[model samples]
Target: MNGFNWRTLSADELEAQYNPRKSVPDFEQHFTAWVERSASARTRLPGAYDLRYGPGPLQTYDLHKPEGSATGRPLVVLIHGGYWRGLDKNTMTFTAEPFVAAGAVVVNLNYDLCPAVTLDAIVRQMQDALVHIVAKAADWGTSAARLHVIGHSAGAHLAAMMAAAPWAGDLGARPQIASLGLISGVFELEPVLHISPNQEIRLDSAMAVRNSVTRFAPKLAGPVLVAVGDDEPQAWQAQSVDFHQACRDAGTQAHLMRVANANHFNILYALADASKPLCTALLRQCGLK
Candidate 1:
């Protein structure tokens, strides 16, 4: 083991080895419950509808429009992260309300999950979804120029990539994203080489290194808020820090925020309220009152 003392490691090491990349407790099941709870939230919020983001019939997204909205409202694209394999956009259905109620449109997106596809395919689908949404933004009644992306976990990772992605010249219609609200997102892919989740994500070190948000930080030049929950595992927190440092080092506007009493799952959940601190910050980022 290259004389490295894996056996003599500390308590953190013991925990890391036993629970590396292990998501916050019951995230999957809790999210499943949240998916069903969308109906309850919808009854109170209303104006929730499904829209097609891509040409494929299966490629659709949930767009949440608030009541009594104003002109040229900003859009918040909320990407739910489930290690790229699990969870649906429904787990994030309730998330758009805060943005919607804040006079911004909220788009909760769903890409093809894993076991049925590769991570590369998922990322491409995500990029295609964003472009398609922007193309439809005018018809959807929002300013396509301004977008505030809020992604949780895996969704955060994809958002980071989109934020830093090179201009795909052929897509046409340049976009203007205002800021990023990345919650508990994985920006660096290197960890997956040793992280068990890679078994399903299938990211080799080379691929992970190339696709890492940290590597493309320079391309992203917006105010980015990398938020995490204090009670979550170290790995979860590290991803935010590493990405923040990369962005900062690249002369981009980026900062880190931690929800004092929350964990991975509830950090994004708490943003459901229009008055929540995270939501308020997102409003501020989008230049809304």
Candidate 2:
């Protein structure tokens, strides 16, 4: 199934492959836990909430600083995954705990969902958020020179897009990104267009091709950790495998991790646990381990 072209698959097959919730019967349980944990994190962590990076109502983020002074610490940005249609920064706040304890400034970002805005618009919103974070890094007690991005699912797609962004040519400056942690990402957007969520995402072929990270070379001079749950559908896992290969082929340092006994939703827990391989790899990338 990994070698089969997604274009040759039937719509039903594609949906079965791409729709993660279909495979995880207790998906709601994960969401419930995340919300509860995030609330607890917000109460315990020292940070500013609802900081706006853009004019949109959803363009806000929560910044959690490390214990004591955050001066010269690495900035870790987290993007939540809701298939570009659901979820927000709030469900992701719990992910900041491990990084914050490791002495990194962590940010949980939010952006406008689909149907209300195009996927391209969401991508631009993420780029804007990165620009804002980089510009305000010093004031926040971090440095853009040691920036690390970690995203899950659709957010991972956005992080890959950021890595491939033409910052110097388009934004007039290049951000010094240290590493990218792309977990359970969809690098090939074409299959997404065939999935049920596309009704709201409204991703046409051109837009899908335009946004597919595998279609372009990454503009990064750092390592990329592309990980997926081994228990995930073969087609879904192939996305990470192929994207990691793409990054390596483009002369970027890339590593692929097949997490055992995990699924799409549960894999995020590994990211929140510093002792886990996924979290440790990211910490090492940020020079924290």
Candidate 3:
């Protein structure tokens, strides 16, 4: 790793850095454990399952409510990441436990994967899903005004996009998102174009710039928590710093958090722990603490 210059690295070198499993040998175990844990959570938790937010077959989510009847609770929408092409919402349901226990309604959402659909289409689906969630808030016995969005990896990029979306005052009933928790997110897509994971999404320069959170001014007025893993590749971790700086440059409240001893896969696990600094900071940002 000596004399490595990320700024001048070749496309292949860049791809290697962005590919976490290549560096971390036990990456497969994380996915295996996530499925087992999430399955147990679904059976133990109480709430609605497979609520459709759009016409697409993959456009559905699981809404886990608090243990008992709790009205007027804040809604925390958790978006899963698979580089926008690889994972499901169910595997991400494990994130619902801490938030639900904290008396916050948690929605684990799914969007159509890439190669099957374009990235822009997925973004639109996320926006549509959120709008539907806000519109159907009363059905879940909660208010939409206290919505918080959290996403990891590719999902984190989408969460930032959601935060930047011009939702405020766009519709009479639209909720003003309270805060954002972007965990281990890839804020800009330009570097992704050269990465191995970009095969499915097939990102072009124009699309990369269009979706990059750092490219435009931050439209979100609420606090934003941009985080990454300390053990991740330098290029991967730099995205958080760049995005946090972009938010600050735009006069928005943003914080950069580096999770110790965590990599791309395990960082999400840290966020699932309520007492962990990552989750604690996010909970506070969402007004849950």
Candidate 4:
């Protein structure tokens, strides 16, 4: 190792040393551990309605209705981020509480995982769930126009894709999403493929671009806050920054912010307390604060 500066190693070599191939989000591990630790937490929220897609275990979402919340209240739909697999709706239970406290009905969604299916298929399944939610929103005490989406990591990418998806070509009805709150979001596919060598990443070249929020700006009804934790790897922050600038330049309402003293795993935790800057920022962006 003569003259081999450790810091000057190539990206691939760096990743090989830093990002182990087995290091995925581990949602299953987290979710199971959570259930075991917290015995009384129900599978779904009280009064939350369920609609199944295929033969798979009818995917569930926990809907939290704000006190005094009625049919016209704003709705924030949250998709959990566990790379592309690993997590379920339970981790997001805490995520729904604050928005509910903020007078918005909150829905934490779940879906099928990869290795069980491809990314494209999972996206479609999510879309179908959203379509059903949008249609039956009235029953859930909200409507599409009252809709907003907040996704972290993989969930953030999916939320952005929904904004860009071909509505007339597929669902016939356009989703009335009023705001987007992307936490630790990945907007570019090249980075996911080239950057962090994490096990949660497994996208083909085309899908990477196709699903990247930066590569495609969906028609957003209002401003979207792309936030990243300050302590994250440079590449993670860069992804959100590039997309935020692109959205703002395109005349779509967008801005980038830094979550102080936070990291990837717990960014959503900050979103749970109304007084926290990230939570405050999210509400301001949603026109709720």
Per-model TM-score on C-alpha atoms: 0.86, 0.96, 0.93, 0.82
lDDT of 2 at 155: 91
lDDT of 1 at 160: 80
lDDT for each residue of candidate 3 in 229-281, tens digit (9 for 90 to 100): 88998878778888888888888888888899989998878887898998889
Q: What is the C-alpha lDDT of each candidate?
A: 0.72, 0.89, 0.83, 0.69
Residues 1-289, candidate 4: write the lDDT tens digits.
1222335557775554233222224434545554443233343334364435334563667667765646677878888877666677666666666676667777778887765766777777677777877877787677678788999877887888777755545766666678888898766665455546334556678877667667567657587888988866565566777778777766788878899886676566687678899889887766578
After the best TM-score superposition of candidate 3, give how far the Cα of residue 215 lies from its true spot, in angstroms: 1.1
lDDT winner between candidates 2 and 3: 2
> By TM-score, how accurate is candidate 4?
0.82
Residue-by-residue lDDT tens digits, candidate 2, 48-151: 98999999879999888977754889999999999999999888888889889889999889999998999889988888889899999998889899999999
* Candidate 1: 10-residue stretch with minimal lDDT: 1-10
Please give the ranking of all candidate structures by TM-score, highest first, separated by commas: 2, 3, 1, 4
Model 4 residue-pair collision total: 3
lDDT of 2: 0.89
Q: After superposition, how far is residue 151 of candidate 2 from its true place, in Å?
A: 0.1
RMSD of candidates 1 onward, in order: 4.0, 1.5, 2.9, 5.4
